[model samples]
Target: MSNKSEALSRRFEAAFMPNYGVPPVALARGEGSRVWDVDGAEYLDLIGGIAVSSLGHAHPALVEAVSRQVATLAHTSNLFLHEPEVLLAERLIGLLGAPARVFLTSSGTEANEAALKLAIKYGKANGRPYVVAAENGFHGRSLGALSLTGKASIRDQFGPFPADVRFVPYGDADALKNAVTAECAAVFLEPTQGEAGVVPPPDGYLRAVREICDTTGALLVTDEIQSAIGRTGHWFAHQHDGVLPDVLTLAKGLGGGLPIGACVGFGDAGTLFAKGDHGSTFGGNPVSAAAALAVLDTIESQGLLEHVKTVGTLLAEGIASVEHPLLKGVRGRGLWLAVVLTAERAARFQTAAQHAGFLVNAVQPDAVRLAPPLVITAEQVTSFVTALPALLDEASHD
Candidate 1:
């Protein structure tokens, strides 16, 4: 580490909580898909702030939008309406191809929390008491969203959560059918489980779940925080299965790099939350909303959805073709991928990749996640694939 990086690390440790552990490198700045550390060493940023940097770093459109919005008007509390927030909500609802009402928030957790409150209200009105979620599916970390998350490692420690939340195995329609009853108020699921190593459900799994929810009178809430915004070569991952959710939660890539989230409710689900049912102090601030609108507009004008499909295939196929003993295969779709290792050496693999001037995430014990910027070029994908064999070899030796 450089002297400056070490100094910053020490300062971070002194000032912040230790929940994230100590980062390996202190990043100074980024452009496109590359970031430079404080020591001036450049690394390809494949994680993209865990799928939050949709347009890469410092893109012209995002920069101009945020700069202009901040200079004009930044925050207008929900007490009064703002043009940017209204435009953003309209754009999101139009993308979903549904008649929906939006409740904007500051993060994915808040979005899910809003969805949970909507579900609880629906349950109270309908005399249902239970909410079903998928095992190993991640929603968010707030107390309410955490109650719906089924990951044991994170959820176990922060217990005494809200009651009547049941978990069924992901990708198993029969299991969900047996678990969701008439008394279930909602079923919260991830179209693709991002934190669970970018695990995609089986074919037609979402359709089956939709049918089950329809039969049981349970609202289907698809948490698309990690899978939306052209991450999976689609506007929303559930759309790939031709399924429409009653309540949809989104964030992560919504504001390009800014903090924002939305909980969109369709049909009757949209009307459950009346005036003053819920609100956020800084949910749809003008700055974040402007950034989000720029992201959506750029994605459409630049044809990034098709670009994601083409480049994602190249990256996935390139990693799969590498004849490395430590590589098991690749999983997930589009740019949201997980390099499955043959063994539990993902941490070592991440360290090795960092040393080799690339940034990836050890999302699990045996999976390294890659959710790069939507603007990442085919050339960048090739470069990463070319370096994979050696990185895997180093991790094996380590």
Candidate 2:
């Protein structure tokens, strides 16, 4: 690490909480799919801020929209209405291809919190007190969302979560069917388990879950925080199975890099919350809304959905073709991928990749996640693939 970066890390440790520990590199600036460290060392940004930087860094459209909006009307609290917020909501609903109501939040945790409240309200109204979620699935870290998160490692530390929440094994249709009884208010699922090393469910898992929800009159809620907004070559990952959820929560890439989240409720689920039920102060701040609008507009204008599919396939195929003993396979779809290692060397692999001027996440001990910007090109992917063998060799030695 550079001296400047080391100084910054020391300052960060002293000044801030250690919730995220210390980031390995202190980035100075970013452009497109690359970022520079404080020492002016450039690295290919494959993680893309944990799948939050949809358009990569310093995108022109995002910059102009945010700048213009902040200069004109930066923030108008929920006390009043704004054009950007309304337009963003409309655009989201239109893209969803269904009749839905949108509740905007500042982050994915807030969005899931809102969804939790909606589920609670639905439970109260319908006398269904149970909520089913998949084991090892991640929603968020806030208390409400945390309650819905089925990961024992995180949830065990936070005790006495909301009651009547059942967790079934992920990608198991039979388990979900058995757990989601008629008394279940909602079933929260991630179309692709992002935090679980981008583990995608079985081919007909989502469709079967939808059917089970229909049979039991339970509201299906899909959390697409890390899998939506063209990240998975679709507007929403649930759409891949041609299934629609009654409620969908999104964030991560919604505002490209700005903080924004949405809790969209469909059909009768849309009207569950009446006046004065739930609210947010900076939910739809004009600047963030404008940025999100720009992201949506650019995705459509540039045909980035198709671009993501083509480039993602190339990257995945290239990684799979690498003749490495440590490499097991690749998982997930589109730009959201996880390189499965044969052993618990993902941490070493991440360090090796960083030393080689590439950034990837050790999402699990045996999985290295790559969620590059949706705008990443084939050439950039090719570069990474070409360098993978040596990076793996270094990891093996370490």
Candidate 3:
């Protein structure tokens, strides 16, 4: 490590919370799909801030839009209106292919929180208060959202959480059918289980869930925080499944690295909140909205949706074709993928990759996750494929 980086690391541990541990490298700068540490070492940023930096680092379009908006109108505090927020709402609703109402927040957790409340309110009015969520599903970490998450390891210590929430196995249509009844308020699902290591549901699984929700008169809420915004070669993963949800929540990549989230309610779910039911102080701030608009506009104009499809296939295929013994297989869509290892050595793989001047995340013991920026190229994907065998070797020997 560089002298500057070591000093910064000492200071960071002293000054900041230890929730995420003391990161070994302090990033100094970033551009495109790469970032440099304070020690002047370049590392390919594969995780993209846990899938937040969709446009990659220092994209000219994102910088310009944020700079211009901050200079113009940064905040209206939700007490008033902002043009960028309105435009973004229209764009999202149009992309969603439905008439919906929008509630903007600061992150995916807040989006899920808002959607949960909306479901509860709507359910209460119709004689239902129970919400069904899928097992191993991750919505957020906030109290209300945590209650809806089916991961017991994270949610156990935080309880007593909100009541009347049930969990069914993800991708199991029969389990979901059994759980979401007329007494259920809504069913929350992640189109793809991201933190569970990019686990995708079985074919027609979403269609079955949709039909179950429709039949049981329960709302369907899909959380697309890490899988949306052109990440899965689609605006929303549920769109690829051809399913319409009553509530859809998004964040992560929405603002291209800025803090922004949205809870969009379709049809009756949209208007569930009254004038005073819910709100956020800095939710729809103009600067973040403008950044999001720039992200959307760039994705559309650059034909990145098609690029994601083509390059993502190459990435998945390349990883699967590798002859490393530690390699098991690959899963996920577009730029988001999980490298399934034969052994539970993800932490060692992560450390090896870091030392090799690459950044990836070990979301599970047997799975190393990769959600690189949408701007990543075929060359970058191939480069990672070529380098991964050495990293796996480093892990295997360790």
Candidate 4:
């Protein structure tokens, strides 16, 4: 059998309940911004594994930290305190520039789940129980998190959701001001809405929401899952406007490709979870925490935040110059970019981009999101931009 087919056969047999479709390419290894398939065909990875590979493949710092910690001590559950977990917490709070409490988990969904529960508990404490979120804002897929997600397709099959959640237009501060009453305990936002096609809010929109929440005494929860941890040229995406969320949900890039997530709570929200209020068995494990610390240290030491902004600007300008009828414009900040195409051409463009030895994603029918690793260079972005006109032409015919 061919090596690729043989590998796929084995994976299909061993795996359980496929959620992501059948495999496309079997990745062998990766370094920097490149990945090679099992057949040894290499491609420039612009999607960055759906924006998870912040430092790209096998970054030396991540390798060293994870290796040392795993060899020394791997999994020590929440039964006791561990150095890696404590150290990571301190670093995260310091970067946020606020007194924050952290609840670590294994993935972004878990972090969102924990955050949703905290909002619920906080609501009960304040004698208010409703939560407010925005249309087209995606939080996560878990039952609790899905309840807050504004996408209808994602939440359609799973009905009978918790009763107290409401949705309004994203970036509509006035709508939020009208929707959130005294009965609402919290409002969740993604500074740049990643999954619903890299939609950045209107200028000063986040600041306005913060003001509205303050006036209403409601917590402002920011889901930084797709835009946080240097993906958007900042420690946190919302920090661009100098706004602090009552609670922040983070993952994707936090562990440098390893599975780790955290819900950071600031001020009074920080102390909401008392002893026995919430816990995760495998949360804050030493190995994952070690990986996160390395990601943070590397970002600071390498000045990757600056690099992201520089390269991302080039990408946006390059995409804008593509000169295709389907190409509308580019949105988002830093490495988190989305190209708006005409009609439902995102899928076609994704296929075309892949065939051209590059990778990106169709976040929606008309928008394609490109969130490459922060490590991607200007030269690589130029190469992708150079190929865009032809790629769009081909995708249009397809």
Task: Assess each prediction's global lDDT (C-alpha) against the native.
Answer: 0.95, 0.94, 0.92, 0.90
List TM-scores for all candidates, in order: 0.99, 0.99, 0.98, 0.97
**Which ten-residue region of model 1 has the weakest summed lDDT?**
155-164
What TM-score would you give candidate 1 relative to the actual structure? 0.99
List, residue by residue over 184-207, the lDDT tens digit for candidate 3.
Answer: 989999999998899999999999
Residue 131, model 3: lDDT of: 92
Of 3 and 4, the candidate ahead on lDDT is 3
Model 2, 168-262: lDDT tens per residue? 99999999988988799999999999888999999999999999999999999999999999999999999899999999999999999999999
Q: Rate residue 283 of model 1 by lDDT.
A: 98
Provide the clashing-pair count of each candidate structure. Answer: 0, 0, 0, 0
lDDT, model 1, position 149: 90
What is the lDDT, from 0 to 100, of the residue 113 in candidate 4?
86
**Please, what's the RMSD in Å of model 4?**
1.5
For candidate 4, what is the TM-score? 0.97
Off by over 4 Å in 3: none
Mind giving the per-residue lDDT tens digits that candidate 4 earns over 1-398?
A: 36775777578757957677655667789999999877777789999988889899988999999999999999878998988999999999999988989999998889988888888888998887899999988988888889999999889799778747899999898899999888898999999998899999999999999998898888999999999999989888998988999999998899888899999999988888889988898888899899999999989999999999999999999998778798898999999999999878988898888778888898899999999999999999999999999888987894
The CA lDDT at 3 in model 4 is: 77
What value does the lDDT take at residue 318 in candidate 4?
Answer: 92
Clashing pairs in 2: none
Once fitted onto the true fold, the runs of candidate 2 whose alpha carbons sit more than 4 angstroms away are none
lDDT of 4 at 14: 76
